[model samples]
Target: MGDEIRTILEQYALQNAVKHQDVPRAGAVIGAILGKHAELRSRAKELNAIIGSVLAGVEALTHEEREARLAEIAPDLIASMHEKREKSSDLPPLPDAEGGVVMRFAPNPSGPLHLGHARASILNDYYVRRYGGSYIYRIEDTDPKRVVPEAYEMVREDLEWLGIAISDIVYQSDRLGIYYEYARRIIGIGGAYVCTCEAERFRELKLAKKACPCRDLTVEENLLRWEQMLDGTFIEGEATVRIRTEIDHPDPAIRDFSAMRIVNTTLHPRVDATVYPLMNFSVAIDDHLLGMTHVIRGKDHIANTRRQKYIFDYFGWKPPHYLHYGRMSIEGLVLSTSSMHQGIADGTFTGWDDIRLGTLRAMARRGIRPEAVRAAVIEIGCGGTDISFSWDNLFAKNRELIDKGSDRYFFVQDPVHLTVKDGPEQTAHAPLYPGDEERGYRTITFNGEILIPGKEMEGNDLIRLKDLFNIRVTGENTAVYAGDSLTEIRAAKGPIIQWLPPDQTVPCRILTPEGIISGVCEAGVAGCVGETIQFERFGFVRIDAVADGCVTAYFTHR
Candidate 1:
């Protein structure tokens, strides 16, 4: 029985306990899955029967050594175990730790993962934990023209960074032969036929304005044509295996759509097969074979579902539940797949992780957490007809789910010196962010030494930090010889240039898509990689990467 029955029992018990003003037993089943009070009261009789059954089942297990019996006869026990197996291979030693839910995050490796893909990945991860199921990672690299090697790597890396691990990794390309065989079987059953009509001609035929010359061919003839097409006997695009459907079908996508095609150009990544099977055909067959109970994908493929359903109907197999979501569109930006591919080819965007391209890896590089990305996507939600998405709103939603952690020191640009007077004669410890009591603060040492062109120190005054610091003016202009010139400078009072001791500071060089940038930081702060915080006296900065003697940092300025 569904969990609804258990919920119903719980509700009944709660109501009874509330009315009687008595403590409810912890082990007592009480909860209502349905609505209303009288209706729930009336269902108590049925609930009693369920409880009796549950008790009897438990009683039967009492003799087989409590543990074995409880496991064997408990209601929903088997189903729960299966769910647990999917989420994680290891069954938690503690009963409370075991969760049974199965989820999969399938992404097309056509391009870099964007916010949408991250959302799907997060949802899959969330549900697996919520329901106690296993998470699977499947590559939907069926479209050879769109799939790229870098995209596959990026999808894996981004998810890994998000701490989402899959129990198994499967690819649709590996199942092309099965799809081709199914297509052939459909042809043998007269459920499919081969069409040699060109694009415009096919459209005309689909529109019922023209007749397809190959439409009336017999099953035998169609089978021979299909086999020839698959074996490369037919020229590319000359013959396509089309499912036999009513010509006047309301949905154009379901009308004799291509099941298999002659794609002899390049090798299929997963299959290495010369011939390419249509996505609709391959996905339907693989989903079934892979034991996928649900198919979650972009709503753009909703139309394809009908065609896939027809294939499943011809095969007499139950199709998985489909959850089609709206495409994650970023506002003010035209995310053209063709243009993105072109950009990758032409080096317009550095790599797939170029922040400007809306790639997940790029977002990760920019310090966007995967959970934040997912929360943003879910806030957008699914089931809406096509609508332009607002990226500003997406980020705004992300802020709701992600915690804005304590700030850290971020140096953004060229250094500015500030002189201070009447402040602390010694160094002052500055907090990274006020109110962040846990994070404490980093110390900035003030040695009472101010560098001015030529200046002398007197009493209390303010020393402005060109852009960063304002310290107390301590001394007058002192002559400092640089190379061959002796320049006179004044000591202004403001914030002092609080830098790490020379021994404590380490030289850092940042490599970005633009070029190389150099800076210095204490080794203690090197662990702040992937953090989004500003450096004191510096511009906004993010810890993109950290390596031994080599770190990559992104700067908003040149």
Candidate 2:
């Protein structure tokens, strides 16, 4: 038991050191050990000693030495850790994906794609790539009333930005003729019928498990009614073609679902044909015709899946393999397209790309990386229970990817001038990225004055200028040199504050989730539009615009 506890503690400590260049937290190590071996819970005192010894040994080694030791002692453990990390973001292989598999991301062009929509798109893309299958981007624009003319292009752009390669682009509006032919065939085969009953009467009959008079109509009569539906004999809501299903089915929704309906074509954005096939009917036919071997979507559409299966059975065609995942909701984010459109119309929101919203465009504008979004969604995978997460969860993932590449710079918000008395004129060089010497550094000359944030000066009598000398704050706006000895600074344990030389600073503003913050940054920030960088001791920000001696950026995360 003692040997096993030591081994687990060492593995965790080595993992932490390799990733974070630090020893594992004592509490975390203990918790992990207890989790792996419940029997050890009763032996906490014994386990703590072993864990402490392992952590002590790990902390004593330099980062390079720790890594080297880990590699020498357990190279397989390191490999296994990498494999686990990779597999966490990977999707399970599709069952019976024989022959070539085809999948699609079908989105209605009523609004821009949000994070919820990206889950389906990324999942399909991931599996298709994994199994050497084909992916399609099908725009479901059958509903003309709600469709946005620009939404189609926006969805395409979002997909491209997300790095999802689509093999084919299809518009459901363009395939109306194919749907019409299928509808007619279903009617001819007595698999569906045109019902002209009043809306309320049809509902009453369906609820009572009784078919309306139109359900038993002859094939010729149904065909005639279907032609009338096409030639303006019927107006919207007056007639609909419903597929024949078991009236005695346990679920009322499964009984004779509508396949095609009379739509006001004049209200539609793209097509003028009066007859429009409903979602389930059109999608079922499209999947079969397009050779989609796998269908990945949310579990809320389980009823729709049952409806679509009837169509497949009627046509004697094989249904695609279904993979339904739960709906994903991000806390405090409004993902409803209708709500977003209403908010925009009422001036509640600036636009689709408003930072407060959850649209993909908004995330992009806020400096969230596309890879981060992909990783977050893939980690959730395809599960049946609904999953809800907070913005902090996503920001943590973004920080991991952004921290290594984002160059660090000083930003003084509400700047206060600090005068350093008896300070020598010196040139301070700071690396763009720590531990990456190849990237080089930026230089700022400090003679006697610099700008620091006003809020950081409240509780400090002594402070160290990061990567520079130390100072003793004797007054609100005055400080004196305190020597450059590393031992003295470490012993003092004063706050290390970031400063900006006034001569080489540029006006800057950061748009955060809470509000906009105005500040000044290093002059090197100029011409860094569309680049992501970390404001020293502040947060990661993406430069949005650069002009008029001011740099505008959006705060991504801390």
Candidate 3:
């Protein structure tokens, strides 16, 4: 029984790690163990001991090593895992999930949605889809200073491209009256008060753990002040409504926190309203009204969660279940919206869709599919640990999703003319999608001259022209036909290079993260706009445009 249990523990630990790209938690391993071998559930202590020992050994191995081991012992597990990956995700069951949970993704309409935003939105949408419910996309566009006029539409486009089917879209700017009504209710119940203290004085009083003199004002006076605020008598920054909390609370920030404040509504891009609810208050009200069962956000919001809970307690509304994920740092992605915004304003970046940015449009332009983004984040898992994102892992996920579907083409960057001295003028054929003959071949007729990438002729050594004859570099600028046998090249282990007959070439430029690469490709590539194709020996590129005999593309990954 012990040996059998040890095998189960080892297998599941490796399987879990492979699924999540992280070390397996003992809880998951135990669940898998009891799920498969019910008889083992009786021996909890024995199973847990085996799990701890097994996980320690598995955790020591690198991700690659664990994958290799899983493949060796249980290739079936790897096969099914991959097949599962290409389709819908198999996310863990949501805790306390009832009959169809309602979730919401509230993004501030200051910029396009980014990867950091994707985690919360994607995870929320994924759960709603898995459990059968509604996913709300709410635009938290209250701050006139941060709101971008174009960002409202940009956010919609980005989310549409990301494949998140939102059940409804709500803008907070349009719901100001609802917020005002709630603010009035909280005031009427004495849970809040309108204060006219100056900014400096209020900060001083809050620091001293004492309330402003206005805190004890009659509800009639507070209501009159609130009306004056709406009537514009109390201009911007003159008065703010503070939620009544324990004034002497230890944390100064939590002491009688401001819930509503005056804003320059005339300058607001979306709505004209003088009074605006702070994030905690507005979020608490919207979550309750929108029927959000769960709130998935970063761990930085733990303090914000406590602040919002105070509002829920005051109103007797049940707060949504909060799942605060830890911060994630993808090595090469720029997740900071403010930095990207500033860069765009100063002309440091082209736009939100620049390949250099990490916005969803940028990823999409580079041939990173929405499904790939969804899969990568789902595998990263919603843990509280700070994890660094691996470009290799993300690329691997994308490659798996796209490899079989992408057609092959040859791109000769910095074309160096190669002269085949003796080979016959034959029409060489290659399958558009290798291994799938039904798709058929694209024919390239070779007379004598062909174009190869400049790097291919750097050595002036012998090489095969891939699916055609072999050639030996006889000079700095040329290669001569040496032989035409596959076995001959295989014996010498010569490098196989991609070549395009000059007559069949079209001018091409690839937008890459490093820089733009100028090249020429087979004429068939001109029609690949809106499609991602593999440039044999190079990487996959998504064709963006074709204008005046020039093809424009963006490099995806190797």
Candidate 4:
């Protein structure tokens, strides 16, 4: 029992340390052990002894040393932990989730799906899968003036990339008749009124807690006006159908909200109807009709929720359960769709897939795996508190997912030629991935001349050419052979610098967040278009294109 407990503690401590990049806490280790071994609950004193012993061993080593030791003992632990984290999300289970739960991701096709939009999509997809329910994809493209025809396909592609399967798809544009029928029913029941008042007048009445004169029109009169609205009798913005609420309601905006209005169908991307239903009206009708049992959206829609509840009450229908999470903001990013569109149009941005943009398309182009985004958002769960995090948080998650697969290569920007005299001619073999021997190696022959980064050559009289041999920098741009002794090299503790044979190199350019970095990379990188690899001591980059004797890649992160 003592040996088993100690082993478990060591594993947990290494896992905890690697995950947080810090010393493992004694309390956390004990809790993890207790969670996995409930039978040890009564043996708290014994477990603490094991935990303390393990923590002491871990704390005695430096961060790098701890990492190296953990890698040696538990090579697969980090990947296993990632799989566990992905499986065991902290999101709370839906209340009373049982049979036949239906959910939907209804996106307005005004622009491409950004990171903020992805959160809602991922949450809905996750819960639906958890409960063995149906997932629906709906495009709420009712606002013609703001709709982008191309965005419809972009949304589909984005959702597909995120691994969200749509069991059913719906477009609000095709449901105009359904909305019209419901609107007429509300009008006949005296629950809604047609108002022809100007926008300015309606604002005045709403602010002053007064009802428009048209609010008291008889049901028959409103029905006649509704027919005129559908018959092209009402020009755009000439009239609107408003749902009636208490005039003295504390929230003046809810005094009487517009249920449907007139928009020029000619301007719309898909539909050809003069009268269109607004979001609150269309969403309420669709949620009830489609049998959606739960609705997940941002808290910014709280007012919309209240308005929809009124519509449900008027129709004697039960509203779906609502889960509203707070808004999430990416540090140093303006996630406004309008701003992104304008920036792309004006050449301020290269395109939607620009590394600096926060759209899912951009993230994908930058080699950020969709699984990483899903896992990060799931870790956040459906909290009501606003989430603010930097890009580093996202990159940290991505690094774990891609680290094992990314092959290593040498790239030197602003190359400084170094000539080594009296050096033996030999072929240097570098492994594609460290500790992954089965992946094989990339070979480069050196004739004693190489190109290294100018910055790395500074203040270093003695340096090791990584995976090859040692060199002593005798002058500014020259070097002499330092005998091939790995022990002496390690004892000296010199900086290990990446080098590329001058003749076995290819022109390369990296698009970093700052700007384009032009350089030369090892010849092995020539055929790896669209492959993500690490530029040793520089950063991870995704090869975007290969053309014109040059390989172009987008820098992901360090």
Instruction: State each model's C-alpha RMSD to the native.
Output: 19.3, 5.5, 10.0, 6.6
Best by TM-score: 4
lDDT of 4 at 301: 95
RMSD of 3: 10.0
List model 1 lDDT by residue over 192-303, tens digit each. 8888888788988788834477878898999888788766788777888888788888877678888788776766665666567777887777777776665666787778
In model 2, how large is the Cα lDDT of residue 128?
82
Tens digits of per-residue lDDT for model 2 on 98-144? Answer: 55689999999988999989899999998888887789999998877
On the 0 to 100 scale, the lDDT of residue 178 in model 2 is 94
Q: Once superposed on the true structure, which residue ranges of model 4 sit more than 4 Å away at CA?
A: 1-87, 390-393, 485-493
lDDT against the true structure, each candidate: 0.58, 0.84, 0.84, 0.85
Candidate 2 versus truth, CA RMSD in Å, comes to: 5.5
Pull out the clashing pairs in model 4: none
Q: Candidates ranked by lDDT, best first? A: 4, 2, 3, 1
Check candidate 3 and list the clashing pairs: none
Candidate 2 lowest-lDDT run of ten: 81-90
Q: Give the alpha carbon lDDT tens digit for every residue of 1-558 in model 4.
A: 888777777878987886776667899988887898899899899887667657766654433355666766777875575464444675787776777579999998877788999899999988988888889898998888778899999999999999997999999999999999999999999999999999999989899999899998999999999999999899988899999998889998799999999987457867667888999999999999998898999999999999999899999999999999988877655578899889999998998788777789988888989998988888778889998855676788888888888998888898999999888888888888766789899898878889888886777677778777889998888999897775565455556677888889999999876789988998778778788898877788998998898989998887
Name the lDDT of candidate 4.
Answer: 0.85
TM-score for candidate 3, please give it. 0.81
